[model samples]
Every structure is written in structure tokens, then in C-alpha cells.
Target: MTVVNKLTRLLNITYPIIQGGMGNISDPNLAAAISNAGGLGTIGVGDLPINEAVYKVTEMLKQTSNPCCVNIPIAVHPNVSHIVQQMINLKVPVVSLSAGNPAPFISLLQQHKIIVICVIATVRQAKKAEKAGADIIVCEGYEAAGINAKNESTTMTLIPQVVQQVNIPVVAAGGIADGKGLAAALALGASGVQMGTRFIATKEAPYHKIYKQAIIQATDESTVIVGRRYNRIRRLIRSEYASKLLEIENKNDDPAIFFKQTTENYHKIGAFDGDIKNGFINGGQIAGLIEDCPSVYDLLETMTADAKQILKQSLEKLE
Candidate 1:
């Protein structure tokens, strides 16, 4: 009946369910709600200015005394060093680093007693993060939303390999949105699960109503892969905008025009403004599994309860 494990204990949360960082469209209220609900809520800073990112993190901290994490895309942020220093200054209890090498900052953050969680899409990256002294590993598969690895590995196949490759606790991400998914991840040796698309469908996620609805109505084939030709490798819900982006990729080898349309500003237009025609919104393949836009607390609670039940049932059936 216990969901308590290395990840929950390490992060000092009630469950190991985590919300993936949403980059530029990051919201503090959503992050706070998750933290207040006894899970490690993460505020994604994406490519935000250092001041803005600090303001968001500070606001989330004010809303909840519970330990929360900040996600920084290390390689892309304009203020990488400054943001890293700000996270240290703000004393953000946990920090998740992605899209870049975490080696340089892992020890520095740990020196301040901040727990480091590295998000990687490949086995090699997971091992490297562990060696770089990451306390946890968030192994995201190609089924995840937004930018992905060029190889497009799935969570089902990736998690166990990463769990075996890294010594630290591994949190499975991509294509996980329910208790069944949670049960599956644990069975695969993952210490926990991180969900992005599922979070967007929740009441607290701050995405446009239309954006959330899109997740609720999504089907397995609703998600399409773009940028494969140019090595951008992102997953998003199929849309006129997505099709146009794909068309560009197919027609031209250079991704300059495609990259322009896929920037965070464009993402903001879809996620916040509900402009689906011109802006692209990120969604994972797991969108097919979501049916309702529950509160974050309800989502986590049900996930843990159901996971426990399913795990017990699965063991009995197997035996």
C-alpha cells in the first residue's frame, strides 16, 4: 500500500509523482498547487529572463513552504550562469537541469545542499548525470511533449535501461498520465513518474481552456512528430500549425524558418492565448489517456491510490 520509495523519501514528498517543466509558459500557481498537495511541484523557467524566473520561483515559495523544484534548460537559457546563481541564492530546495550538461553545476548546487535532478532522454545521458553527481534522474522518452531526443526512444523501453544504468533514483517521464501508468513505471524499476501532458489537462495548469480541452480530446494518433528531418525532434498535437511546420521540414533541409515558428513566443500563443492556427502547443502521446481536468491534488491522490491497487492486483494475478 505504500508508495513511499527512494524518490518520495529523497524529495520528502507524499508520492513520487512529478510535473514536468513547461519552459516559457511556466506557472507558479500550478507548481504551488502540486507542492501543497504533497508532491514535488516543479516550476519550469525554460528560457525566461533571470529576473522573471526568480520572481516566479520566489512567488511559488511564498505560496507553499513545501519543498519545490525549479527546472532550468541549461543549454538554451540566455542567463544560464545567472539563473544557476539565482537558484542557489533563492535556496530552491530542488533543481532540475535539462537540455545541457549538468556536470558543471551539480556539485555547485549540491554544495548549497540543493538536490539536483537531471532530466535526460538517453541511457548515456542518464549515466553521465549520475556520474556528475545528480541525486535523481528524470528519464524522458520520445513520447514526451516538446523537444525530444533525435532517436525517439520510448519510456517503456528507456526507463528500465536507465534504471540499470544509473545508481540514483530514476523518475520515468513521457506517456504516463494515470495510476496504471504509474504502476507500469514502478514495475519497470522506475522510482517514480513525471507527467507533463497530464498536468496540462488539470484545472490548475493555467493553460488556455482550449489547450486543456485538446488534451482531454486527444487520441493516440492525435500526436505527431515534427523536426525529425532537421534533427529538432519534438512531439506536439497534430494541428494546422504542426502540419505547416512539418511541411517546411519536409521541403527544406535548413530548419531556420521552422525554428522561428517553434519558439517559446509561439508556444505561449497557443498555451495561453489559445491560438492554435499560428502557434504550436506541446503534448505527449499520453494525452489519449486523460479524460477529465481534475484538480492537481485529486490527480495525485487518485494516481497513488490506484497505483497501489493495481500493483497488488498485478502481483496476485502474476502469482
Candidate 2:
């Protein structure tokens, strides 16, 4: 039996699973792998130059004929217009905007007939995004890795609230790693689910072996939020570098100091180079649930199958 929803029909994918566009980690190979597996793959262009972003998208296009998405964190990238134009020029099928308002660029992307998905953390933001012409809303909760909203809403609370507030399809994000999580999101009225940390441990992901190992070895307490004191909340694996950053944050260090520690360079070193001592790795609370590295195909196939069985069992119990 196939599960279908607005999200699946909108993107024309076989599954409602979306690969979270992790900066530096969302490479062409990984994106193509997920897309080829009948899920939405996203290429994350976090603060990269417009030309580089175009090149990455171009490379992704060459890998798979399947539809892929390009994610633009509006707050970090300076030339938003240029990047949007590049996507339009390339005929990218979908675009996901995050970290800032989508009102300004929504119409431009819509004009090109590209499906626009806005990442929001609050009911107010979800409503605003819908009004601003977002084709879909990805309700990312605080349990997610990287920058999170100050309200710190969990996926359980945020997904249902956003679904109730918006008419558009709501894709649940954060703290979702398995078929059980997928079933829970569906129960909460989410049309689909997006995963970040869970995908990091996959074989197709370009992250270093050690980074994947860290996720597999993580426990419920192995991850912690580091930048809360500075108001730039981010969840990361508990490491010497992360611990040091937390210690400095507690001491009320300069914002610049904290900013330096959280730069993309550090992310590259830790995530790509496996330099855990000098760099930190970003992960979500769901990291604790990951046990092995599988190919994207195997992961998604098993997840969907498990979700079908679990949901079926749940319905029988209700009867």
C-alpha cells in the first residue's frame, strides 16, 4: 500500500519524506541518492556565494532526473535575489526558505511556478507564510539541530498547532528519526516529515565516518544545546569543543567570540574532517535513536514499510 498526501503530490515524489538541507553536508551525491529513492532531496546552500550555489544545484541536476530542492536560509545569504534568480534560471522544481521571512521572495519564486516551502517554528509564522504564498509549511521544532527558535517548542507541540493554524500542508520536522516518529507526525496532522540528524548517519551522506559514528554512539543525554545563553540556540553532540563553548557561553563572553566558534568553518572541520577535538558537530535529540549507517534506499524503504505496519496495528487497536 502506498501512502499519499498533498506533500507527495505537490512534489510528485513517492514518499512524503524530505531530506533536511544541512549546510555543507547536503552534497550532490546525497541529494540525488534521496531523490532517486523517491523522497525529496535538498541541496543546502547556507551562506555560500550565489555562483557556488548555482554550481551545486547544477551538479545535483546532473545526478538525478528526480525533483530536488534547494534550501536558502534567508538570513545568512546576502544575495537572496541572485540565488532565487539562479534557481529560476536553472528551473529548480522546489525551493525551501528558512531563518527569515518568506514574504519578499515568495511571489518571485511563485512566478516561476516553483513550489515554495517555508520553514517556520511558530503558528504566527506558519500563518504569515501561507498568506505570503508559501506552497507548503515545514514546521521545524526546537528539537531539531542547528539554529532554533527562542520559544523552544518540541515537534509534538509545534506540528499539531501549525497544522491547525494553516490551510496548507504541514511537514513535521525535528526529533523525528524512525517509522514510529513518522506515524506520530501523521497522527498529529502533518502531511509529511523532514529529517536532518537521522540522515547524517546514512551511507549516502558525505559526513566523515567519525561524525556518523558519533551519532550512532550518542545516547539521550549525549546531545545538548550550546548557544542558548547568546540567544542563538543550537543542539550539538557533547564533545570537548562543545563543552568548552558552553563553558565560555556561561561566562558571558562577547557575542563575536561565540559567533566565531559557531562559524561554518568549524562545522566543516567537525562534520566533514572529523576533527572532534577542535570542532563541534551539530545533531538533534534523535541522534540517540540512530544505530547504523544504511544506504538512503534501504533507510527510506524500511521506514515507510515500518510506518505502514505500525499505523495499521494502531488502527486495529483502536477498533
Q: Name the lDDT value of residue 276 in candidate 2.
A: 85
Q: Pick the candidate with the highest lDDT.
A: 1
Which residue pairs in model 1 clash with each other?
none
**Model 2 segments more than 4 A misplaced:** none
The sequence of per-residue lDDT tens digits that candidate 2 reaches over residues 1-319 is 3568888989999888998988755688889999999999999999887777888899999999998999999988888878888899999999999999889999999898999999999999999999999999999998898778999999999898889888999999999888999989999999989998998998888889999999999999988898877888888998888988888898866878898888888888899999988888999999999999999988888888888899999999999
Clashes of each: 0, 0
Task: Give the alpha carbon lDDT tens digit for every residue of 270-309 in model 1.
Answer: 8999998989899999999889999999999999999999
On the 0 to 100 scale, the lDDT of residue 124 in model 1 is 91
Candidate 1: worst-modelled 10 consecutive residues by lDDT: 1-10
